[model samples]
Target: MSSSSTFPRARKPKLGYDTDQVEEFLRVARRAFDGTPAPGDPEVSAEKIRLTAFGMQKGGYSTAHVDAALERLEDAFAARERQIAARLHGDEAWLREARTTAQVVSNRLARADGERFERVNPLVLGYSVKEVDRFAERLSRYFSDGWPIGIDDVRTVTFRAQRGGYRESQVDLVLDAVVDVMLAVR
Candidate 1:
C-alpha cells in the first residue's frame, strides 16, 4: 500500500517514521487483526503495537499521525482480546481479572514519591522521579478516587530523564498493565 494513502508525509527538511517499514507493518497488522495471519509472521498483539518503533527518514510518514493510528490499532486489538477472553471465561471471570490487575497497579502506585519504582544507577539516566511521581499521583487518584484518566493519557505520557531516577522498563510495565485493565473494563 502507498504510504501517502495511509498517512501524510512529514514536511520537507523534517524527519518522520520510515514509510516502507510502517506500511509493511500496518499491512501485517491488518491481517493479524482480521485473524488471517500467515505462517512465519511475527506475532502481532496489542502489546507489540504499543512497543513498535520505526526508523526515521526525511519526508517520511508523519510521526504524530502514525503514532495516533498505532494507538487506535492497539485499542482495537485490546478490545478484541477482551471480547475473546470474556467469551471464553465468562464476563464475571474477565472482570475479576481486570480488578485484580487494577489492584496490583494501585498498590504499586501507593508507594511514596521517589520510592514507587526502582531507581537506576547513580550514573545512569532514567525517568525523572519528580515527573513520574506527579503522574503516579494522578494514576493513584484514578484508581482510588475514581478520577477520570483516559488510556490515551497513560499511553502518550512522556517523562523527562534524570540521573538515578525511576527505571524506565518498570514504569512502562505498570503503564501497560494499567492500559490493559482500562481496556478490559471498557
Candidate 2:
C-alpha cells in the first residue's frame, strides 16, 4: 500500500497476520456473530477487531520496526553533534593555552629589557602585547591588599620628560631613573 514497492509473491504467503491470533479471534467472533448478523459487521472480539483495523490502517507496517528505525536515527544524530562539539572545544582549549604561553614569553622579554612599568603598562607592540611583566606587579598589588604598593601611588613618576624632543639616550635615562626609584622603595 506504501510507495515502497514490494516484490510480487509467486504464491501469496500468510506472513502479515499472526495465524494463532487470527484463529483465537475467529473462535471469539463466532460466538458474537451468532447473536446478530449486521451488515459489514466485523465479528472479532473488541481487542482483535482493533488490532486488525490497526494492521490495515498501517498498511501492514509493524509498530516495532517503525520505532526501532526512529531510535537508530536519533542515536546517529546525537553522536554526530557530540563529535563536532568535542572538536570545537579542543580548538578553544588550544587557543587559550597559546594565549597564556604568549603572555609568559612576553613577561620574560620585558624583564630582560630594563624597562620601567608605569600605572598604565608601557609596552604595546601595536595590537599585540610584546611585554607583560607589569601584569605581575599589578597582580601583586591586588593580592597584597594594597599593603606595599599603594593603589593611589601607582602613578608615582617623580621626574618629568624633557620638553625639547627626547633623544634615545635621554629616554633610557628616564626609564633607568624610574626603575631605580621604585626598586629603592621596595
Candidate 3:
C-alpha cells in the first residue's frame, strides 16, 4: 500500500563526517561503552549498530559517502592486519617458536628426501624454547605510552586482528605479557 522503499532514515549524516571523525566514530546506537563481556563474546551491539545503520540506509547514501566510509574502514582493517602480522613476522619469541617448530617439520621433510634442505631452509633447528623466552622477556622490557586500555581492550584488539590470520592463542600470550608489564609499571 506504501510507495516508500525505506523507513526511518539516519538521524545524523555520518557520511558527511571528516576523516578524523570517522576514525573515532562509534555507531550512535550503544547506550554506553561499558565493561567487557566474557571470552569468545562478540561486540554485538556495537557491530549491529554499525551494520544496520549503513545497510538499512544504503539506498539513502550518496555514492561518495559510502565510498569514503568503505575506504576508511578498509584502511583501518588493513593497518590492523599488518599490526598483527608484524607480530609473527618479527616477534623474536614467535619467530623462535615458529623457527623451532619449522626446523622439526623441515627435518622430517628432509629425512623423507635428502634434497629437502636444498629446497627449503629448516629454521627450527636454530630455535630453542629458552631462546624464545629470553627474547620475550626482552620484549617485555619495552614500554609504550598513553592511558593504556584495560584487559578488555586487549581482548577487543586481539579479536579484531584475528581475521587477518592472527591465532587467538598467540594474541593472548603476547597480550598477557604486555599487560603484565604495563600493570607492573602502574
Candidate 4:
C-alpha cells in the first residue's frame, strides 16, 4: 500500500493541483494497485497514467512533484505486469520476445544518427542526435553482448533537446519498448 504521506501536500494557492482531489485519486490508485478495486478507478495503464490530468487548485499539489510520483507509479505497475506475464509464459517465451524487440530497436539505431529518427524542422527542438546515438550504441551492445542493463536505466534515459535532432516521440516510444523488453526478461 502506498502511503498518502509519500505524496507531497499541495499548496493553498490555485496554482497547484487540488489537494483533496489528488489525494483521493492517489488513494484509489493505490488500492487498485494492491488488487483491490476502488470506485471510479482509472485504468492503471502506463499510457493512461502518462497522459493523466489533474485539476489545479490555488494551494494544490505541486505539478512537478505529482508528475514525478505518477511516473514512478507507472513504472511499478509496468514492472508488475511484466513479471506476471513472464511467470505465466515461461522464460523461453519471454526471452524470445525480448530478443525480437531488441532487434527492432537495434535496427532503428543502426541508421546514421542524423537519419535514425524523424527530424523536426531545423528551428524546432528535438532530442540531441549525438546523445541519442551514443545511447543507441549502448543499447546495441546490450542486445548483442547481454550487457548488464536494467529497465530503469532505459526508462530514465534523457536527451538534450536540440535543433534538427531526432524526433523526441520516436526515441521515447522505442525506449518504452526497450524497458518493456528488459522488464519482461528480468
Candidate 5:
C-alpha cells in the first residue's frame, strides 16, 4: 500500500465518484505499477485505466481531475512497458517490428478512400472518408520522412461521420498499433 500522503483526496460534492472506493482502487493500481507484489492484484494495463469505472456519490473525487490524472498514469505505464520490451528484444528487433507495423498501416492507407476500411451499415454513419484519408496522408509522411509526431496526436484524432465512410473500428485499431510501435521505438 502506498503512503496516504501520495494519494490525492477527493472533494465532497452533490454528485461525484465514491472517494474511498476510488482511493482503494488507485492504491492497487499504484502497487501494480510499482511492481510491488500484492496478492490477487491484477497487473495494471493502459486499457484497464482507459476503461476504469468509478461509483458516483455526493462527496467524491472531481471527475475532470481524476480523468486527467488517469491519462498521465496510463501514458507512464505504456512508456515503461515499451522500455521493458525494447530492453528485452534489442533495438534491431524493435525497429523491425515498428517498420513492419508501419508498412501495414501504409498499405491500408494507400487503398482508395472509401475502400480503405470496411463501411458501416447503410443506416449507421462511419468515419468521414475525406478526413481519414487526409490524416492517413500525414501518417504516411511521418513514416517516410521521419516526421515528428506524438502518440497523443494519433490518440486524439477525430473524424467526422458520414453515411458511407470507412469503418471507425478499423481506423482506430490501426492508430492504436501505430501509437504502440512509435512509443516502443522512442
Candidate 6:
C-alpha cells in the first residue's frame, strides 16, 4: 500500500482524485518508467500521462499536487522518448519530424478566427469560438514570432462553452497536437 502522505489529502468536504486510483496509477507509471511493465499492463506513454484523469472523492489526493506530478512525469517520458528517437533515427531526423509537426500546427493556427475549427450547431454546446480564437492567436504568435508560451499554458487552457461554437473535439485534438509539437522540441 502507498503511504498516506504520498500526496496530501484534500480539505474535508472538498473532493480530489481518488487516492486508491491515483496510487495504483502511480505504481503502474513507476513500472513503466523503469522499463519493467508487467504483462497485461496497458502501455504507458507521455501522451497517456498527459491525458490521464482520475475520479474525484472526498479526502483523496490533492488535485493540484497530482496534476503537477503528472506534468513532471509526462516531461520525463517525453525527454526519454526524444533521446531514444535521436539515438535510433539520428538527431537530424528527430529534428525534422519535430519541424514537420510544428509546421502542421502552425498552419492550423494561422487560420482566421472562427474558421480555425469546425463549429457545432446552435442547439449543441461547444467551446466559444471567440475564446478559442483568442488562444489560437497566442499560439500563432508563439510559432511565428517566437512569443513566450509555457507548456502549462497550453495544457491548462480552457474556453467557455456556448451554443453554436467551435467543436470541442476538434479543438481538443488540435491542442493535443500542439502539446506533441512542444514536447518534441523540448
Each model's Cα RMSD: 1.2, 33.2, 16.6, 3.9, 4.0, 1.2
TM-score versus the correct structure, for each prediction: 0.95, 0.20, 0.22, 0.72, 0.74, 0.95
lDDT of 4 by residue, 20-97 (tens): 777776877778788997667766665556556788766556777887787788778767776776799976786788
How well does candidate 4 match the true structure in TM-score terms?
A: 0.72
Candidate number achieving the greatest lDDT relative to the actual structure: 1
* Residue range 1-186, candidate 6, lDDT tens digits: 455888999888899889988988898999998999988888889999998999999888999999999999999999998899999999899889888988988898899878999888999999999999999999999988989999999999999989999999989988988888889887
lDDT agreement with native, every candidate: 0.93, 0.35, 0.35, 0.76, 0.76, 0.91
lDDT of 6 at 175: 91
Global fold similarity of model 5 (TM-score): 0.74
Candidate 2 stretches with Cα past 4 Å from truth are: 5-56, 91-186
Q: Which stretches of candidate 1 lie over 4 Å from their true place?
A: none
Comparing 3 with 5 on lDDT, the higher-scoring candidate is: 5
Cα-based lDDT at residue 46, candidate 1 = 87
Worst 10 residues of 6 by lDDT: 1-10
Model 3, residue 103: distance off in Å is: 25
lDDT (0-100) at residue 44 of candidate 6? 86
Residue 88 deviation, candidate 2, in Å?
1.6
| For model 4, the run of ten residues with the poorest summed lDDT | 1-10
Instruction: Give per-residue CA lDDT, model 5, range 27-119, as digits (tens).
Output: 888898888948988768876775578988765667766777777887887787767767998768877887898889878877875677888
